[model samples]
Each structure stands twice: as structure tokens, then as C-alpha cells.
Target: VCSPEYWVRHVREAVRFADGVRALEAQGVSRFVEVGPDGVLTAMARECLTAEEPSAPVLVPVLRKDRPETRVLTTALAELHVHGVPVDWERLFAGRDARRVELPTYAFQRERYWLEALTSFASDVTAVGLIPPTHPLLGAAVELPDADGFLFT
Candidate 1:
């Protein structure tokens, strides 16, 4: 699972990796295979490759869905077959099982009183024209950019 903060920080990294892969495709790299538990990276790779080279080679993911081991392996083999890659289904499906584990639960709740206080402070800052309305961080918090004017100093 990726958080908004994680996306904000690594989006540029993803873009850079895509650019490099696209360059490789320009040099006759035919196929791009993304092997991982999830296909999020593959989706990003498709976006990058499409932007750089529309006719690039096939982008394949080893795991197509979040499911039991059997389903995951079956989907992977099917994808390979669709791409004309031969595989031993028995060997691939060997030692696969559906394992279940308990996940922890948290009972924390948001502090409404804190949120209200922050919102009120933010309104005051906005009214004073300290931060522009178009600023990306404007709606996230209730703090003036330079409440003490130390930023300019």
C-alpha cells in the first residue's frame, strides 16, 4: 500500500526509471517484464513506455491480481502463454498454497477538536493574505508562511 506522502516523494524516481526504460526500448529492447507482488510498477512502466514509444514491446506482470497462490500462478502462466512464452504449469504451481494470517487492528480516531482549531487558524492566515490561495500546502494546515515575518528577514 502506498501513501500520499510516498507518492509525492517517489513519483520523480518512478518517472526517471521510466525514462531510462524507454531509452532502452528505443535501442531495440523488445520486452519489459515487471516481477513483483503487485502491478503498480508495471502500470507506471506502461505509462512511461507509452509516452516515449507507442510501439514498444509488451509489458508483462508476473502477478496480475491479489489472490491465492494458485490464482496468482495461473494468471501469470496465462499471461506468459498470451505472449507466446512456453511454461511448465506443474512446476510453476508446485509448493503454492493459500496462507491466511491475522492482521492487527488499531482503534485510534481522529482528533476533531484539534482539526477544528487548525482549521480556524488556517482561515485566519488566509484572511491575512500571508499565503496565496493557489499554494499546494494552503489547505493542508493552518499556519502562515511568515507569521513572525522572519522569512523575509
Candidate 2:
């Protein structure tokens, strides 16, 4: 069901997602992975593909309803890898002794006035924006340098 806020905010751009998918398709973006609570946009995305694409782009989901989380994720990752997406294998192995290599070239360092401007970089707000309460993952948001966007978790 659509909410009143959604009707107001998104009715103007009801085809936004499908249009975005078409744009990506035009740019030769064939692989799509919807990393959400479940597979919501897969069908709509598939529908957006054009016949000129040679083949419909591979679409995968990270989550599914009534399915084991780990199993679904692993299968999706494997499918993506098979379809030529370069996922970092190192992400699967955590807390292991990671080997580091030193660079042969010397490094250059530069100082910034902004670094000394505030005790906490997070406190400085260059812009303020509101994420609607009806937003899927972000119920609210405040940009911070300490973290990427908001912590929906």
C-alpha cells in the first residue's frame, strides 16, 4: 500500500526506478544486484530491459523471504561472480592474519586547514537534508564524516 507522503513525494516520479534501470541499460550495465531487505525491484528491473541489450542483464538479490540468509547471499554472490562481477573474496574471510605489502615508492603528505578547523570533523555541517520518515532504509539522516550516511541498523 502507498502512503499519503509517498503519493505526494513519488507520484511526480512514479517511473523513477524503471527509468533509472533503462538508463543503466543504455550505458551497457547488465548486472544488477538489489541489496535490500528482499527482492523488491528485480521484476521491474527485468521488465525495463530492451531487446537491443543482446541478452537481458543478470539480476540477483542478496535476500529473499522465507529463505536462509547465508544460503541466499552465497548463491547470489556465486551467481554474480559467474556472471563477471568482481567481488572481493577477502570479504568472506574476516579476523584472519591479513598479509600487508609495503609500497616501493615514497608517500607524500599534505596538511589541510579544515583538519584544524574543528575538534570533531563530524560537528561541521556544510549541508542539511531531510530523509523522509517513510524512506525504506533511512527513517532519518544526518551526514557525518565519521560514518557513511546514516546507520539504519
Candidate 3:
């Protein structure tokens, strides 16, 4: 989808999730802790809850501080503790835990030579104003098309 439609869908989904959180609050859930890579979800939850209920749950995001990758999880747990969210890290990381996993990575390979050639052709065509007047790509100096599909009488 285009940029405007993509953004509109994103906003709608966010609002729907927010509404779900509000429904949970209506059912008397007074505390929420969002655990994820970023705090975006927590922020949205906060906004949704505030809009629905003046006095609602305490929102907490586990990872808010900057730290090395190795220490980030531990730091997040500590921060959650300081914010009064109890966590059982030892149990969560008990024995036989897989320390690492492998996955394939791909590199982007495009023919820049062909891309440059196409760009040059397009620029030359635009400079000459040879494109049809009714085409959306035509810029400010577009000549209006006649009823018979010609540019002028």
C-alpha cells in the first residue's frame, strides 16, 4: 500500500489494541507490565488507558535504560523491581536454556548500473516534457488534454 494508507492502517490497529486494554481495565485489571524490545506498546497502552479512565492501571515497561546487550536484560529486571514489578529471573532462565541460536542472513544485491541508466532516461524525458499531459507524473507545466485525447487543438 502507499504511504498514507499504510500509516492510516497502523493508527487504526493501535487504537484497536488500546481499546482492548481499556476493556481489560473495565474488568478491574489495575496493573500492566509490557515486556518487549521497545517501549512503544507501553506508551500506547498508557495513552489508551488514560483516555478511557482517568485513574487506571500502573503501566511499566521493563527495558528503558541503555546498556550493553549482555547486561540489558538484567538491567531491565532491576528497573522493573525498582518500579515494584516482581520478576523471577532465576526461574525464567533455569538450566538447559539454549544460550544461542543460528539463523541465515541475506545481503541486498541490485544492479546499480541498470538503475543509473533508467534514472538518466527518466530525467531526460522529464526535461523534454514528452510525457502525456494527463499522466499524474507530469509536473507543474502540464498542458491540459483535449476531449479527443490530444494535448491541444
What TM-score do all the candidates reach, one by one? 0.40, 0.50, 0.36
Candidate 1 wrong stretches, greater than 4 Å: 1-15, 50-56, 93-153
User: Model 3: per-residue lDDT, tens digit, 20-41?
Assistant: 8879878877677677765568
Q: Model 1, 18-96: lDDT tens per residue?
A: 6777797678666666777766676677676644545435666666453455555566567657767787755665687
* Best of the two (1, 3) by TM-score: 1
Candidate RMSDs in order: 19.0, 17.9, 20.7
Evaluated against the true structure, the overall lDDT of model 2 is 0.67
For each candidate, the alpha-carbon lDDT, in order, equals 0.57, 0.67, 0.58
Best by TM-score: 2
Model 1 Cα shift for residue 151 (angstroms): 56
Model 2: per-residue Cα lDDT over 1-153, one tens digit each: 378977777666555787888899888788999988888788678887885654558888788776679867877887888888887757774676865566535444463334244544343333224333446554455433222245332
> Which pairs clash in model 1?
none
Model 3: how far residue 122 lies from native, Å: 61
